[model samples]
Target: MENKIKILLLEDDDNDALLIENILTTSDLNVEIIRAKNKESYLELLDKLDFNIVISDYTVPHFEGIKALVELKKRNKNIPFIFCSGTINEEKAIQCLQLGAMDYVLKDKIEKLIPAVKRAIKLVTETLEKEKLEKELIQFKRAVENVHEVIFYTNPDGIILYANKAFEDIYGWKIEEVINKTTPRILKSGLYDKNFYSEFWNNIKSKDHFVIEMINRTKKGDLIEIKNMISSIYDANNKLIGFISIQSNISERKKKERELQRAKEAAEEMNKIKSYFLSNINHELRTPLISILGFSEELMNEITEPELKEYAKYIHEAGQRLNQTLNNILSLVELEKKRIEIKYESINLTELLKDLINQYSKEAEKKGLKFITKFESHKISIHSDYEITKKVLSIILDNSIKFTNEGGILLSVRTEKINSFTHPVINIVDTGIGIQSEKIEHIFEPFRQVSEGLTRTYEGLGIGLTIAKQLLDLIGVEIKIQSQLNKGTMITLIFPTVAKEEEIKSEVEKRKITIVEEPYEKKSTNPEILLVEDNPGNRMLFKKYLSEYFIVDEAIDGLEAIAKAELKSYDLILMDIHLGSGIDGVEAFKRIKSFPKYKNTPVIAITAYGMTDDREKFIDAGFTDYLKKPIMRTELIETIYKYTYKNN
Candidate 1:
C-alpha cells in the first residue's frame, strides 16, 4: 500500500506497444509503465527500480521470451511476469508459468489483456501480503508455544489443528494424538452442559473471545478443572479461521476450596450441638448445687453443734467433688475443640510418677487400697507437656482407686529403642471391676460408664477417661488396654521420647490456689443467685440447698431470669430449662450472656437431661459448669472452687 508498483512493457513492434499502452490507460490501476524496444533497452530498464508486473513479448527480434523471463526471475522471483504475444506456444506458456510468470495474454484479444493484467497484479499484491503474514504468524506461534499455559487451536467441527507442548503435558497426550482428536471426545469430563458449550461457542463467535471454567479428562483418565480463554482467529478477508485457546490446571485449588467448605459446615453443626448441650447441662447442675449448698448452710447455721456441723461439711465436700467433675468435663471439651494451649516441656518420668503416687496416696487409703510403683528406670526423661501427662497419670490412678476394694494398683514404666529414636511405655494395672467385653472398646468415649450401675452409686462424672484420651491424642500418644470382665484391667501407653532433654528446673508444687475469703465485708457472703425453675419441689429444694453459698434468688420462668439478671448484680446464676414461664433456659442464657456485665461470671446448670454433648452446649451458652441432679456436696464445691479459685 505504501510503494507505487512500476510496470515494464517490452514490445519491439510499435503497434503492439501502443495497444498495450491503451489497455493500461483504460484500466483502474496505479502503475508506472516503461517501454523497452530493444534488448539493450530491456537490460537498462532492469537496472532501474522495482516493478510489480512485467509484460513482455515472446518473440522479440533480439531477445527471446523464456530467456527474458528467466533473467527477470533470477533478479526478483516475486515480481509477476505476463506474456502478451500473438504467436504464443503452449510449451512456452507453460514454461513461463513454471518460471514464476503470473499468466499469459494474447495480443489479438487485446480486450482481454487489461482484465488479465489486472487479476495478475491483484494476485501479486495478495501473495506478497500473505507471505508477510505467514512470517509474522510463525513468530507469534513460537511465542505462544513458549508460554506456560496450554495453548491449542481448533476448528468449528472440534478437530484440533495445533497444540503446544504444554497442552500435551497437561493431558498426558502426545501432540500427534491431540492434533488428530476431536475436542469433546478426547477430553470430556461429562461435567459440562450442552447449553453451556452452545453459549460458549456463540459468545466466541459473536464477541471474538470467551472465558470459561470446565472439568476435563486427561489421557490417563484423571479429571482436572481447567480455566480457559478462547479467541476466534480470522484472515485478511475477515473469514473465520479457527480458535486459539489458553488454559490452566486448577484441580488443587478446587480441592482446597471443597475441603474448606466441608470444614466450615462441620464447625457449624458442632456449634449447634454445643448450644443444645449447654442449655441441658446448666439446668441439671444448678438444681443439685443449690440443694446441697442450701441444706448444708441451714444445718450449719441452725444446729449450732460442732458434731452436727461435720455433717454439713461432708455435704459440702460431696457437692465440691461433683463440681470438680463438671470442670474436668468442660476441660475435655475445650481440648477436643483446640480451645486450650498446652506448654511443652522436658519432664523426668521418675519424678513425675513419684509425684502422682504421693498425690493419690490419701485417696487410695480412703478406698482401703495400696498403691505400688514398678520403676523400670531410676532416671528417665522425655519431651512432653508435663502438666497434661501428670493429669493423665493422675486420672488412671484415681479410677484405679475408685473401683478397687482390696487389691493393690501397680504403675510401671520402661523405654524401647526404635530405629534412631527411643519410645517410652507406661503401664497401669488395677485390680478393680474390669471393663466388660463389649464396653472395653467404648470406655474412652465421654459420658459412658460401664453398665455395672457402679457410676450411679459411685461419686464420678464418668468423663475422666474421655479427657485422658483427648490429651493423649494431642501429644501423639497411643493408649491400649487389656481387661477381664471382673478380674483386673491393664492399660498401656506408648510415646516417643526426646533424648536431649531441655530440662525444666521449676519446682512449683501443683496445688489448687484458694482466694482469700473476706468474712467481714459488707458485700453479701451469699451473693444473690438466680434460680430459674418450673417444678415447685425442685425449685424449693434447689433454694433450700443453695441458701448456704449465696442469697437465693428466684425466677419462676426464663423471662424472669433474663429480666432479673439484667437489673441485678447477682454474683452467680442457676438456670433451669423447660420453665413453665415463657422462653427456655437456652434462650435465657443467651440473653444473660449478651449483657456485658454478666459475660464472665460463672453460671451453673441444673437439669435432669444429661448427655455426652450437653457439656459443650452449656459452656458455649456461657454456663461455667453443669451437673445432673440430685447434686452431691463435693460436686458443688468443685465447681465453685474452679470459678472462685481460678479468678483468684
Candidate 2:
C-alpha cells in the first residue's frame, strides 16, 4: 500500500495524457503513469506490464476505447478501466460505460474523471474482500453437513434453528419436519424424569460442555441409545445465542454390550454347577472306589491260588484303568477352564523319570515291551511346578507304553545349547506305532485322535497329549515331537535348569517329595495312629493297612476322633475329609491339633476330594500332608513313615 498506484494510459495525443497526470498530481494522489502512444503500443504494454487501473482514449488512432476495454478485461477480469474522450459525445459516453467501463468523461468536463477513478478503485477492493469471505463460509457449511454424527444448532429459546443432513439420515426425520418445526421434546422418549432435563441444561451452562449416553425416540417410534454432547454457542459479544449438539448413534454397540454381559453371567452360573458336579463325583464315587481298589490290590498280592489271583488281578487292573480315565477327564476339564494354578519349585527330573519307569514298566512288561532308562547317572535337577511336571511326563510316557506293543521305550538325557542357553534336555524315544506327519501338529488339540471311528484300536480319550502340552506351556517347559508313521516317535523336553542347591526359592516347596526306592526298616517300638473315617469298610481297610507299622486306633466320625484325641494324642492321625456329614475331617483336625500333646503331631488329610485345587486347599489348611484316596499300601505306608521319621 506504501507503493505508488501505477496507471497504464492509452492516448495518441500527448496533451491529453499530460493533462490527466497533472490532474492526479494536483489531487495529491501518489501515481506512476506509463503511456502507450497508439493502439499497437496499448495492446503491447497491456501484455508486458501490471497496473492498478487503466485510463484510455475512446477514439484512438486504430483502436476504439471499447475494444481496448474488452481486451484489458480478457487478461484481467477485475482491474478497473475508465474511458476519456476528447469530444463531448453523450451517446458515446453512455456506450463506453455500457461496454464495461467504470466511468466515462469528456475533456471539457474533466473534473469528474479523477473522482470516478478513485470511487471505482474503492468499490473493487470491497467486492474482492466480500467474495473471499463468502468462499470460506461455503466450505464451513459443506464440512458441517457431511459429518456422520448428528449435528444441529438452536436458538437460545431451544427452538431448532438448523440441522445437517446427518440429523435426517441418522434420526429418521426429514429436514423440513425438524428444522424450526419442533422442540427437543420430539426426540425425547420420556424415559428421563424432569430432573434429568434440568441437570442436562444446568451442567451445560456451568461447564464447558456436557456429555451423556441418553435414551431417545426416533421418528419411526424405535427407541435408541445416543451418545449426546452439547455445548454453548456464543456471539462475538460473548452472549449465549444458541446450543450446538452432537449425537452419535450407539444403539448397536449398546446392544452388543448387554448381550456380552448376559453371556458372562450365564457362563459363571454354569461353572458353579460344574464345580458342584465335580465335587460330588470326587467324593461319592471315589470314596467307595478307594476301598474296592485297596482290597482288590491286597487280594492280588496275598492270594495263593493262580485262578483266584488272576481274578483279583483283573479287578485291580480294571479299577486302575477307571481311575486313570477319570483323572484324565478331570484334568482335561481343569485345563480347558484355565483353573489349574502352577506352583513352580525345585524338582528332581531324575527321580521323576525313575518313578514313571517303575509305574509303567509292569504295563510295558504285559505287552512284552522293554521300558528302560538311559540317564540314571544324570540326576537332572530342574525348576518347575513339581506336580504338573510329573503329570506331563507321566502322560507322555503312559501314551508311549499304551501305543507300543513289542519294542522298547527309552528315556535319555543330555546337555545342549538351545537358543544360546545350555539346557538339560530329556528325550523319550519309543519304538511304538508312530504318528502320521500331517497329524502330529494337531495332536495337541483336545480329543483329536489320530485314529478315529470304530476302526481305531487304541483305547484312550485322546486328551493325554493335549493336557501334556498345556501343562508344559504353563510351566514354561518346551516339548517337541518327531515321528514317522509306523516307525518311532521321539519327544524332546527342554527343562528350566535348577538354580544352585543353596539358592532357595522365594517360597519353600511344601511338597518336597523325595522318591526313595529303598525299603524302610521297621522299628521295634511302633508309633500309634488314629484313623478317623465314617465308612465301616474304609475304617477296616485303613486299620488293616496301617496295623503292620503303627498301633492304629479308630474313630467313625469327626466328633469321635476329637473325643479320642482329647484322651490321648496319637503319633499320627489319618483324617478323612467327608466323615458321614458330622462336622467333616478338616474341622476335627483343627480341634485335635489344638491339644498340647498333639500340637505338632502329623495330621494327614486323607480324602477322595482330589479336584484340581483340593490338594493345595487342604495343604494350606495346615495338614501335615494330603493323600488322594484309593491310596495304595506302599504309598500310604511311605507317607506315614516319612512323617513319623520327621517327627522323631
Candidate 3:
C-alpha cells in the first residue's frame, strides 16, 4: 500500500474540489482531502490538521489563494502551496505564484494537476530537510563562537581556511580578512627561530599531535604567550587533510612566573644582608653584656652587704634578659633555615607546666594580675624535646601575661584525641587585651603587630608567636588561636604522642657525653691559657672571668694569637670567630693545630656566630668545643675546669 498524503483544499466550488481529488486518486497515489470553502474554514482546518500540501482555487468569490498563502507565510508554515483556478488570467496566475504558490494549475486543464501536485510534494520534502540542516549549522557556529580559546583550521600548506570568532577576539583580526590570505607565521613574534617550527611541524606530522607554548603578536602589535595544541586532521586512509589549532592565552601566567623569579632572587639577597647585620650586631652587643654580667656576679659573690649584693643581682638579671633576646633572634634564624635539631625525651607535662607557672607568676602578680593553673593530673607524660618545649610554653605564657592587664590568666593541660592518636593539649586563656579579628591571622608572621606608631602601647619584637609556632611544628605539634576584640584570647597547643620506645632511648644515648680523666695528675697552680678576641672589652671580660682559675694570655687577632701560641706552650685557647682584619677563629685554630704541642691542647670557639652550622664548622676546623658570647661566669669557669683539670 502507498503511503497516504494529506491535502487541504481551499476552494469555494464543490466541482473544483471534487475534480482535484479525482485527479490525485487517479495518479496511482494515496490521497486524502480536507475542504475549506472560506478564509475562516481554511484557517480552522489549517490549525486542526497537518497537511502535506495545500491546493487552493485562486481568485474565488470572497476568498482567494493569495490570502491563504499570506496566512501560511505569517504562521511560518512550510507546506507546499499550489494555485488551481478556472477563471484566472495569466497576470493573476503570475501574481499567485509570486505570492509563494509552489505551482499553478487551471481547472479547464485539470489533467495537469496530478503532475504539478507530485512535483510540489517532492520539493517540499527536500525543502524540509534543507531547513533542518541549516538550523543545525547555525547552532554549530554559535557553539564555536562562544568558546574561550582561539580555534582555527588550515590547509596542509598552513594557509588559513576557517577561523572562529574567538580567534578574532584574541588575535585582533577579522575572520573575513584572514581566510585564504594569512598563515600561522603571520602571528609569530620571532621569539622562536626557524629550527623550533621545523621540529614542531615534523613532530606533528609524524605523531598527529603537537602541544607547546607559543609567543605570538596580535594585529594591534601586542605580544602574548599562548599554550597552543595542534592536531593533524586525517582521513580514513591515514592521509593528512588539514590542521586544527586551539590556543589558550597564558600571558598573565608567564608574567607572574617572571615576577616570582625576580622576587625570589631579591629575597635571597636581603637574607644574606640580614645575616651579616645580625652577626655584627650580636657580637657588638654581647661584648659589653658579658662584662656587665660577669662583674655583677663577681661583686655579688664578694660583697658582704645585703643591699649591695641585691643591686648586683638586679644588674645580672637585666643583662640576662638582653642575652635571652639575642638568643631568640638567632634561634629564629636557625629555625627558618630548618637547621634546629629536636632532642626528644619523656617529659612530665605537669611538672614542666608547674615550673613555668611559678617562674612567671611573680611577673603576673607584679602587674596586679593573678595566674591560675589547672593540671589534669600530676603524672601526665609525653615524649618531646625538653628545652624546645619549655621555650614554646614560655612564649605563650609571656604573651598571655603581657597582653592581659585587668583580668587574670588561666593555664590548663589535659589529654585529648587528635585524629587517630591521643595527644596532650595545653591551653592558655588570657582575660587581658585581646587581638583584633583581622589581626589574628597575621600574628604568627614575623615582625607583624596590631598597633603601630611611636605611641603604641605594647612592646615586643613580634617574633614570640612566630618562634613558638615554628618550634612546635618541628616537634609535630599544632597550635590554634581564638580571640575577640576587647574580650579575651585563648591559645591551644596539641602535642602528638610519641609511640616508639626506641626514639626515647636513642635521644638519651645521643645526649650522653663522657669525659676522660688522666690517672696521675701533674697539676699546675694556674694553667696557662690563650684568649683570642678582636674586641678589647670581650677580651678583658674573659680574662677577668678566668683569671682566678688560669694564667691568661691575650691576643688581639688571629695572627697575634698564632704568634703567641707558637712561642709559648698554652694549656687552652678561647678563639673568637670574627677577627677584624686577619684570619678568623676557624682558620687560626687550623693553623694552631699544625703544631703537635698545641694540637693536643683544647681550643674552644668563642664568638657570636652561633648558628646551627657554625658549631659544626668550628669543630671541623680543629676546635675542641664551641661557646656562644655573652658567656655566663659559672659556665665559663666550669668549661675551663673540665678541660684544664681533666687533661692534667
How far is each candidate from the true structure, as Cα RMSD in Å? 24.7, 22.8, 24.7
* 1-648: candidate 2 lDDT, tens digit per residue: 356778898888878888988897788567788999888888888999888889888888777888999999899977789887777477777777677788877788888887877786676667667878999889988998999999988887678988999999887899888888555688988898999888777767765455667899989888989888888888899999888889999899778767866786797689778756865685677777798799999998899999999999999988888788778878866865667886767666777777777888887888898887787356666767889988988898888888887798998877665422346788999998899999999999877887978999887778789889877766656688999888889999987543232222111121122212344343445688889887899989888877855788787766667766765557889999766333458767887787788888989998753456777788899998899766766568889988885533
Q: Candidate 1 — what's its lDDT?
A: 0.75
Where does model 1 exceed 4 Å of error?
1-268, 272-307, 452-459, 500-648
Question: How well does candidate 3 score on lDDT at residue 303?
Answer: 97
lDDT of each: 0.75, 0.78, 0.79
The candidate, 1 or 3, that scores higher on lDDT is 3
Per-residue lDDT of candidate 1, residues 354-451 (tens digit): 76788787777777887788877787776678888988888888888887877878888998764334678899998998888888889987777865
Clash pairs, candidate 3, are: 404-432
Off by over 4 Å in 2: 1-59, 62-77, 82-148, 154-160, 180-185, 194-213, 228-246, 260-275, 332-341, 346-354, 357-383, 406-431, 434-446, 469-484, 487-648
- Model 3: per-residue lDDT, tens digit, 463-563? 88888988876665778999987788999987765433453333223322211132324346567888989788898888887885588878876667766
User: What's the residue-level lDDT of 159 in candidate 3?
Assistant: 87
Each candidate's clash count: 45, 0, 1
Best of the candidates, lDDT:
3
